[model samples]
Target: MRKVSRDRGYHHGDLRASLITASFELLAEVGLRRFSVAAVARRLGVSSAAPYRHFPGRDHLLSAVSAAAAHDLRSAIVAAADRAGADPSSRLASVAEAYFRYVVRTGAGFHVIYAAELYAVPDEARREQTRALMATLLELASAVGVPSHRQAVALVEAIVAVAHGYTTLFAEGFFAQGALTVDATAARAVAAAEALIRAAGDR
Candidate 1:
């Protein structure tokens, strides 16, 4: 896509959307340590000052980016859960697998969204996105006869923790020495989630 030049005078109809798309690309390419408004502007082919027109500062831009990422992750989890039939174990497995796939697809940007420093709880939309993700997991746990709300919550926490840890390790190449196919790796995460849910039911 032809990026707007600094001299182009913002002819595009949606400058904010353009900046966000550029920001995601730049972050994925360089990661959080080197992220800056200037890099985003460069990706958009605009002057360094161009992003400030929409974002005020890097934090605001990052907040928006992180919020978008969180929303996408929630959607993926919900969709996968819905598609995995009525079995709670299958739903949990599908959601866990979806999460791992998302990590593989988004990597550093995925970490950025989940980072508490960037995605503050004060952001209502992001907060709701997080709640929705938990609600889906909790619903699945309840379906599996986890016995009580508190137990279901604990089961969900374990599921998310294990899935996140696996994704982080996998993305960082901790498992690079293993000849693991994406399906096999996702299966491992799914199995962990199922085991946690089943153990909760047993207990």
Candidate 2:
């Protein structure tokens, strides 16, 4: 029931981009359930239907946001791999650390992309984007000698799951009661992940 603006200048200056940005902001503030097209229009100073010109509906907007987030994550993993130098093992470790860091730093966006139930239905386009993002990590795993393509994919998936689970627990203050700092915990987790990957390779 939010009010929409009657302004006419919204068409110029990347209205679609503006609406997407506003939608992400609202998503971070209130999450998916409370987010609405009317609310986004209110935030963007446009008529409620204006967004429909670009996004068919709220689901489309959510999908766009999820795609953007997936792209960002893919870029981050690539950068982390590059920063880890030419060593495959180092690259794998760096990717795990980077993935964890991304989830923690971009918690809201990460939640929307991975945890939001709005995208429960399999959208081919979104799935493709997510697959590409995961492929980067799998490629890194392969480079690190994960035995085979299937093994590489499995290793990357396991590492990512561990990192994500630990990060979620960390965010919930699971380790705050301990004497370790967040950085220390993350380092330990990354090290453990590296060891696990190496062991898997040996097997």
Candidate 3:
């Protein structure tokens, strides 16, 4: 006799992906402190134990989500640099603009990727991935004669700071004071990046 299964929608081979998707939705709704594997399973209409088959626990699941977010961020950065041609200054500006645009586009996912303390997982891999992506901007700064590794890194950090700061301020409605549009804000971010590169050269 054939036995009936009781997993409830867990038969789909893509349940792992589904669980990840649900986790993000839950994250958007309740945030990381309250997010749980059982909630993801419930969202998938599966047994609470179903997620354990794919992820050992919530921390592991969050790590996967953070990794995926980093991959997406890397793609956006690469595309922006490619579009800016071979000009180092142009590439820096483009990449910075793209970073801010991506933050505006993806919102909370950006925080999930970069905010390490929230997830309670090792973020060395994520940091390395971020470093790799930032390497292009650093190389461009170097090409344009930043003169030393420290200065190049400093320029990159300054640019990233502007982008990150703008993202946070915009999210918090700080831009509402000026009624600045996203395009306007991104333009300012690009200008800030370009100014930092020029300032490095001046020093």
Candidate 4:
């Protein structure tokens, strides 16, 4: 599935969509810092100037990619939480697990969706998508009980931080140095997230 998404060649049809798909591969290959519209065009066998017809600049292209990534992330979180059944704690833990798993499985996904450079101003659509995703975590965190409303926000933050932190470590080869697997890391994220949620109730 991952291979299919990354390696899809642009035989015909919408060239704009093809550019975005090619950008995904370029991003995963070289990351955001070095990503280029020219490179994506080359990947699609289009002229270096081809992507400019759809996207005015690299930032515009990246915004489109980030928006798409935000939608994908939201879907993954909702599906994982729903599958966890009626347990509030399980649902929240599953959210963290799903997020961690997604970042590891899809290269440049987390970074692309939450890029610091782009969010300085933020696009309305992207912001709304992210807000919806965070709202789910906030709802689940509230269900577990918080000493105060502010603490509920903190609970959600802690879970997201832990999941992203673990994923970043895994990406940096911190887990590969040992006998660790993606599933194992995701479980660890779940445990850490659960522990934090439980502790939040104690406070």
lDDT of each: 0.73, 0.73, 0.72, 0.78
Candidate 1 stretches with Cα past 4 Å from truth are 1-11, 108-111, 118-122
Among these predictions, the greatest lDDT belongs to: 4
Every model's TM-score:
0.80, 0.74, 0.75, 0.86
lDDT (tens digit, per residue) of candidate 1 on 73-187: 7778878888898887788767678878776665433457766565443567666765676676678778887668998777777777787788777766787899677788888
lDDT at position 115, candidate 3 = 61
Tell me the deviation in Å of residue 182 in model 2.
5.0
Scored by lDDT, model 4 comes in at 0.78
What tens digits encode model 4's per-residue C-alpha lDDT throughout 1-203? 12324454655668887777677777766777789888888777778887899888887788777777777777888899899998988988897888887777655455677777676544787778767766777887888767677888888888888998998888788988786898999999999998997787676
> Model 3: clashing residue pairs?
none
Global fold similarity of model 3 (TM-score): 0.75
Give the top-scoring candidate (TM-score): 4
RMSD of 1: 4.0
Ranking by TM-score: 4, 1, 3, 2
Q: Which candidate do you rate higher for TM-score, 2 or 4?
A: 4
Model 2 local distance difference test score: 0.73
Q: Model 1 clash pairs?
A: none
Q: Candidate 4, which ten residues in sequence have the lowest lDDT sum?
A: 1-10
